[model samples]
Target: MPPLRPELQAAHDEMDETGQDYAFAVCPTWQGDAWEVNTKEVNIYSALSGTFKSHAEATAAGTAWLLGV
Candidate 1:
């Protein structure tokens, strides 16, 4: 896999601080051309939430959730 986007990396790092293992990846949507950042536990099969258009959005949302912001 390619290196994760910086925002994603930051989110991962933030998650790590909480002892939650999560993954951030770009996934193709059922809409064909649409793609999103898929956030989930590292070894989980389902996504924790809906996808975001870019890594930064995904990271921001995930980070906020984690921080209860």
Candidate 2:
């Protein structure tokens, strides 16, 4: 598996406090111009949709989704 990006690592750290089993990924768009956040355990939380302009935005969205904020 590829290493987690800094933004993702920070988001994961925040999510860890929620005490829930959540799995997600932040990936680059096909055009390599944006970021996308996808969750494996959508049943546990609302899926974060739409592409983000940067890794930070994607990470924030994922963190909010996992933390239910």
lDDT per residue for candidate 2 within 29-49, as digits (tens), equals 667799877664634433366
Question: For candidate 1, lDDT tens digit of each residue in 42-65?
Answer: 544244467667656756665665
Best by lDDT: 2
Looking at model 1, which ten-residue stretch has the lowest summed lDDT? 39-48
Model 2 residue 37 CA deviation (Å) reads: 0.1
Candidate 1 residue pairs in clash (backbone atoms < 3 Å): none
Off by over 4 Å in 1: 1-46
Off by over 4 Å in 2: 1-20, 42-47
